[model samples]
Target: MQRNAFMLLMDEPRSTLDPIATAQVDELIDELRQNYLVAVVTHAMHQAARVSQKTAFLHLGNLVEYGETGTVFANPTDPRTESYITGRIG
Candidate 1:
């Protein structure tokens, strides 16, 4: 007998991969999401928005906000979150 319940935690899984490898990993991540909870930590906003159903915006090691990815990205409640997302802070 085998246990099937799982959670996949990927921390910068694509950080060192080339474009081809990145795409492969992305596909694997998407596929795994069907059967497991996938938690990814990435600086790539596009990837975050694409793969995650929920998003958390953290600043200076503090959780500034957390909510639906589209809502958070489109209309962030916190000024700091907005500043970082829109390239105003960096």
Candidate 2:
């Protein structure tokens, strides 16, 4: 069988995955990003930290911050970003 959705922008496909399998898909997305452009919508900050070299913070449909992952995580220019990273606020 094929590995994953390289570009799932068209056609209806059944999501026949259990919780464990779904998690695997997330991991695969992170790995596939090394060779392809991947856009992942996730709420887990740590997950973004693991998969992305760049992190973008979106609050209320507005782009609040965008930059290097390490720089943003370690020192965010936006107060919201800082709070999100430090687990103080989100």
Candidate 3:
């Protein structure tokens, strides 16, 4: 049988995987992006920066920022987003 999926939602997809396995999953996510919208929820900032084209920052159950990954990482507008990314807060 053939199946079709529109979007993929993942929560901490690599939280338990070893380095090699994590790389493999990252690659898979890259490939899947060609055909599906992928949303990943993770606490690993580096992974999020590496794998996401767009990023969102949430704090205390509120949305703080959302934008292109590079901008979000390099020039976040919110102080809380900057703090979390810079390891000052979480």
| TM-score of every candidate relative to the true structure | 0.83, 0.66, 0.92
Per-residue error at 75 for model 3, in Å? 1.4
State each model's C-alpha RMSD to the native.
2.6, 5.8, 1.9
Model 1: which ten-residue window has the lowest total lDDT?
A: 1-10
Off by over 4 Å in 1: 1-5
Ranking 1 against 3 by lDDT, winner: 3
Instruction: Summarize candidate 2's per-residue lDDT along 1-90 as a digit string, tens digits.
Output: 246656422111115556576567667766676766666566666666766687788888999999998888888999988887778876
Residue pairs in clash, model 1: none
For candidate 3, the 10 contiguous residues with the lowest summed lDDT are 1-10
Which ranges of candidate 2 are over 4 A from the true structure? 1-27
lDDT of each: 0.86, 0.69, 0.92
Give the candidate number with the greatest TM-score.
3
Shift of residue 3 alpha carbon in model 3, Å:
3.6
lDDT of 1 by residue, 28-84 (tens): 889989988898998877778877899998778899999999998999999998988
